[model samples]
Every structure is written in structure tokens, then in C-alpha cells.
Target: MYQTKTKREKIKLFLIILIPILITQVSMYGMTLFDTIMSGRAGAADLAGVAIGSSIWVPVSMGIVGILMALSPIVAQMVGAKQDQDVPYTVQQGIWLSITIGVIVSILGFIFIDPILSFMDLEPRVQHVAKYYLISIGTGIIPMFVYNLIRCYIDALGQTRISMFIILLSLPLNIVFNYVFIFGKLGLPAFGGIGAGIASSLTYWIALGLSVWIVHVVRPFRKHHIFRSWSKPSFKSWISLLKIGVPIGFSIFFEVSIFSAVTLFMSVYSTYTIAAHQAAINFASLLYMIPLSIAMTLTIVIGFEIGAKRISDAKHYAYMGILSGMFISIFAGAILYIFDDPVARLYATNPEVIELTKHFLFYAIFFQFADGIGAPIQGVLRGYKDVNITFWMSLVSYWIIGLPSGWLLANYTNMEAYGYWLGLIIGLAAGAIALFTRMYYLQHSLQKKLDTQQS
Candidate 1:
């Protein structure tokens, strides 16, 4: 419906989409950031405990995120093609899918959490906090999934600000909840690190409630009748979604689980090592929101363009997004390099932890450089529906190449925890190169098709 005939127009529209999404992504991620910061204030043991628990939770939750992300392209294409009637059904099926997966993951999380934590051989206090942390957060899985699905639908329609508004409302509440439950205000016993999980769970439910109300009240969203139109669950529809979604889910799982694996592996080291590693990783994740938001917007913009049969425009958008990501990474790296000490102190008061965190932050600068390029290419590929290859690429790059190399370096050499971060840099660089190559191939192939048709 909007025109993007010139590069200027495209950039303008991209900013329009990118800004709200940036706010939403940052606000949503802010919960985790606050969790780490607040838990760190409680004690090094608590910080390490939440870090361990997050090592378990993030991959599972993010995999679900990737799966539900299929809805973005699905609905974006529908809107672009003016298949308005079909949008509601697809969105509805997505909700059904979310609910089913949420329930299953929650149940499995409760069953497996104790055993997983036990296997880690963490310190007793750390293990107790980790176990109960997972359990507490497990209660919110359903609402989180459902909320994310609705958010995807809204984003695909280019109504990103709605989701932004919803998350903004929830962000403050999360901090308040954390303060209350984490510190044991109002005459309650302090839960220490486990309170972060409890706060996050409550935040999820609140966000979901806000999402439902907003979607029902908002004009274009309500026009789709996502609530009023209910169709019975369709296995065929589920299959179609899984066809696009499962590979994405697994791809994200492969990438994120590498981080979790690193966290678990770091546990064998001293508590200072674990806490420092987590602080660095957490800060890196926060910085990652920039490229990540750009990549997500790329998915929506490029998907809509592809659906509207504007392959040239989609290609242009892809180039713009990937370049912007790289440029931003350079800026971010400079900031991290300059402010490493102050940033480390933000997470911990201990001099040892702070020093170790600075070392890790130095390593993270390289990690972001690779991720800046690789992450957006993944989003562009998703817009083209070229996903299966990404899954294999992630597995090979992260698990096969990255993890083993880090283990060898950490265990066999003097680099220690720093070795693992160097491995991440290598893995991410490899994945970025492979993905860029893939994106290049697809762009030319699509261009040829478009040229032939025009001729």
C-alpha cells in the first residue's frame, strides 16, 4: 500500500518499521537485562544461579520464538497479496499451534528441569536457585507463546507500534514485580534469584493480557476478526506452518543452545568466572537488539515485497538491512571498547568479577561483528523462505565447528574461559560467510527470473 520506488523512500519506511520494533525488542529484552542486574545485586551466587537457569530457559523460549515467527512472513505475504480473508484463519491456526506447543514445553520443562540442573553439578545454592527458577518461569510459557504469536501478527501487518505499546506497559511492571518478589517486600521471604523467574512469569501474563485487549480494540487487527473467527484445529494447516517453522525453530535452537552449552561448561570454573561470563553475554545480547530488530523488520518488509511480486524491492531492502547492521556493529564495537570498565561494573560490585567481565566484553565485540552480518542474512533468507539450509549451516557452524573448538581451546590451552569466546567469534564468522553466500545466490537467481519475465 506504500510506495518505495526510491532508495530514500525505502530507508524512510525501514526507519518507520525499525524504530518501533527496536523499542519493542529492547523493552522485551530489558526484562532479562533487569533480571541479571537485579539478581547480581542480590549476590554472586544469585547472579550465577539465574545465569544457569537462563542457560536452560533461553534456548527453549527462543526456539518457540523462531517457530512462531513463521507467522510474520505468512501474514505479511497475505496482506501484501490482499488475501485479507485468509489472514484470520492463518492467524487462528497459529494461535492453536502456540497453545499446544506452550503446554507441552511447560510440562516437559517441569519434568526435566531438576535432572538437568542436577547434571550440571552446580554449587548447592546455585543449583537450588536454578531448579526453582526454571519451575517458576515455566508457569508463564503458554501466555508468553500466545503473546508472541499475536505480536507477530501485528508486526506482519506493519502495525508494530501496537506491540511496542503493549511491551512498554509491561516493562515497568516487570521491574516493579522484580523489586517486590526478589527482595521479599510486603513481609514475604526473599526468593533470591528465583524471584527473577517469578517476576518474568508475571510479566508474561500481563503482557499477554494487554495484547489481547489491544488486538480486540485496534482497528486493522480487529478487522481480521482473530478472536471471533474460530476454526477447528487442522493438521494440514499445522503441517504447512511446520514446513516453514520447524526448520527455523531448530536453526535458532542450534545457535542459541551453543551459548547455553557454553554457560553450562563455564560452571565447572569458579563462580566469578561464571558470573563474569554471564554479564558479558548478557550485555552482548542487549547490544544485539539493534541488528536483531533490523533483521526482524527485514523479514516483514522483504516478505511483503516478495508477496507483492516486487522482487527487486525485496533485494534492495535486503542489501540495505545487512549493510545497516554491519555499520551499526562498527559503532557498537567502538562503544564497547571505550566503555568496557564502566559497563562491567554495572553488572557486579566484586573487583574480580568486574575485571573478568571486562575481559569477556573485549571478546564480545568480535562476537557482535559476526552476528551483525549473519543475523540479518538469516532474516532475509526467511523472507525468501530459504530456511532448511540455514539449519544445517547453524548446526555445522556452532555445534560442530564452534563448540568443539572452544572446548579444545578452553581445556587444552591457557586461554581458559576466554577460549570459549574466541570460538564463538570463529563460529559466527563462518556462519556469516556462508549465509552471505546463500543470500547472494538467491538474489541473482530471483533477479534473473524477474528480468526474464520483464523481457
Candidate 2:
């Protein structure tokens, strides 16, 4: 039977899931933040190289991550419907899929790394660093995917705190690795920008090890007997996962690629501009973890409620999640506005880089507002498994409307790099409206169906 949670109970539960996921998300992003900071300390060439390399790597890898993200809602609904026996099989299949995609993407990265960097027409120093950075990071892609796949499973089982702890433990080690590799500490050769990738790769492997240990030793996860039962590779299961995962993967790719595209566009300017763009966007992403975590929690909460046939509870959580996201964005926006200079100073010592970064942060304020609304709605939509429309909407908003408009303004008008930020604002606002309308439609449709069944 579906358990009906009270509004206060729902909010409490929401925070329980949201907080650990927030910390986990933040800790993961922290790895990238440190990479950028450490690389910057190495030099502008190193910083820009890592930034460009990251621009290429993040969108591609995250698209794959998005594909794996489907496991969360898939597992949540099964848990809600009391299908515990099937959870292990579902996760095992996800593991199979993760390894497959990871290998394919890793191979593609190595093959295309040279061509992609060559096409960018970057300075020789920057190009060399970017190439090696991607190669180093690419080595750990399989472990990273497997780790995230397991993370989705664990989080779906309401053990987000465990996932949070795993990442927290890894964060300090990632810093140590970065310090040792980037600066030749502890008898290691200095690799500069490449060290960031080496550090990240090592971190991924360690996190994967810890995740495996947790699933084996942790009481709650051990009960699932995920390892005790072995399931053969099933094409049926792969199709089931891909049905939900593929669109999600593409949707994230579309949204993230726009930013990557912008970074590529920025490369035509100066090394200082690319470094500044990376810094501003990096911090903005850190702040974005709030709404994103809320959204992810909604996916779990609402998916479970929906699976249990508790429509009202799902709607309630969605409303609460969206409102909470918007409220937090307001506070984050103020912080960005007030602390832009200080924030920019954190990323670069070069005066020109700092000044350019401050300008980008100003534009990020508007970007955050739209994302606050849109991101949680996305979580709500994912909870409903209404992903196909999202993929199309994201394609239109980010690629069709956002990128084209930004490209024109940057090329034809005086806005230059700022044009892309305005374009991002416009795109996100449009996406928010589209997604919000879709969420309301689904809620109403579900209510109508429920009322009819009652009558």
C-alpha cells in the first residue's frame, strides 16, 4: 500500500535526501574547482588548457552520466511498488551498460582528442596541455561510470548519506593528488594542467573502490544481495534502461554542449578571456548545486510517491522543491552580485582575468534565476519519466534558440562574450516556461484520471 506522508513529513524527508545529495554533488564539483584553481596557479596557459579540455570532457562524459542517471528513478519506483527482488538485477544491468558505454567513450576520447584540439586552433602550449589532460582523465572513465551507477542505486535505496560520506572522504585525497602531481611534490614530476586530470582519474578509482566496499559491508545495501546473485547480460534490460536513459543523455548533452560551444567560441578571443569564462562558469555551477540537488531529491521523492499511487504527495513535493529552488537562487544571486570581485580573485591573480571574470558573474545572476525554476521542474519531469519532451525542449532551447542567438550577438554586436551569457539566460527562461507548463499538464492529467477512477 502507498504510504501517505504529511506535508511537514514530506519537507523533512525532502531535506533528508536533499542535504546528503547536495554535499555529494558539491564534493564532486569541488574536484573540478580544485583542478581549475591548481591549474591556474601553474600558469595562464595551463589554466586555459585545462579549461578547454574540461569544456570538451564535461559535456561528453556528463551526457553518458545522464544516461546512467535513469537508474535513480527506475530503482525508486520499483522500491515504491515493493519490487525489492528485482532491484539487484536492474542495478547489475546498469553495471553492464556502464562498462560498455565507458569503454566506448574512452576509446572515442583518445581517438578524437588530437583532432578536436587541432581543430580549436589553440596556442601550441595550450593545445599540448589540453591533449594530455584529456588523455589522463580518459583513463579512469570506466571506473567513474561504474561508481556513479552504483551511487544512483544506493541513493535510490535512501542511502544518500552514505554516498555523501564516500565523496567527502575522497575530496581531500583528490586535493593531495593534485598537489603532488601539479607541483612535483613527494618525488613526482610536475605535470601542471595534466596533473588535474591525473588527480581526477585517481579520485574516480578511489571513489569506486569505496563505493564497492560500502555496498558489500553496509548493512542496508548488503541486504539487497547485489553481489550474491549474478545475472546474465540481458538485451531486454539494456533496452529498458536505454528507453529512459538515452533521451536523458541527449538532453544533458544539448544543454551542456551549449556551454562547451561558448567556451570554444571564447577561445577565439584571448587566453585571459577563456580563463575568465571558465572561472565565472565554474563558480556559477557550484552555486547551481542547490537547485540541482533539490531537483534530484524531487525525482526520488516524487517517483516513489507516484509509483505508490500517491499523486497528491508527488505534486506536493514537486511544488515544495520548485519553490525551495527559486528561494535559494535568490540568495545565491545576491552572493554572486555582492562578492563578484572577491570570487573572481579566487580563480586568478592576473588583473585582466579577474576583471573579465567579474563581468561574467554579473550575467550569471540572471542565468541562476532561470535555472532555479527550470532545473527543479526537470527533476519533477524526470520523476514522471516524462523525459522525451524534455529532450526535444532542451534541443530547441539550448541549441536552436540559445546558441544561435548567442553566436549572432557575439559576432555581430558589441556584447562579445557577454552575448553568450544573455543567450543562456534567454534559453533557460524559455526552458523553464516550457517545462513548468508540461509539469502542470501532467499533474492535471493525473488528477483527472484519479478523480475519474474514484467516481
Root mean square deviation (Cα) for candidate 2 = 1.1
What is the C-alpha lDDT profile of model 2 across 1-455, one tens digit per residue?
13545878887888889999999999999999999999999999999999999999999988999999999999999999999888999999999999999989988877887788888869999998999999999988999999999999998877899999999999999999999999889888999999999999999999999999999888889988888768988989999999999988898898888888999988998999999999999999999888888888988988898889888889999999999999999999999999999999998999999999999999999999998999899999888898999999999999898888888889899999899888888888888899999999999999999999999
How does residue 367 of candidate 2 score in lDDT? 91
- Candidate 1, residues 62-133, lDDT tens digits: the string is 998899999999888888888989998998899999999998998888788778887886899999888888
Off by over 4 Å in 1: none
Model 2, residue pairs in steric clash: none
CA lDDT of each candidate? 0.92, 0.91
Query: After TM-score superposition, what is the CA distance of residue 412 in candidate 2 from its true location, in Å?
Result: 0.9
* Model 2: lDDT of residue 146: 96
Q: Deviation in angstroms for 400 in model 1?
A: 0.9
Q: In angstroms, give how far residue 94 of model 1 lies from its true place.
A: 0.4
Model 1: colliding residue pairs: none
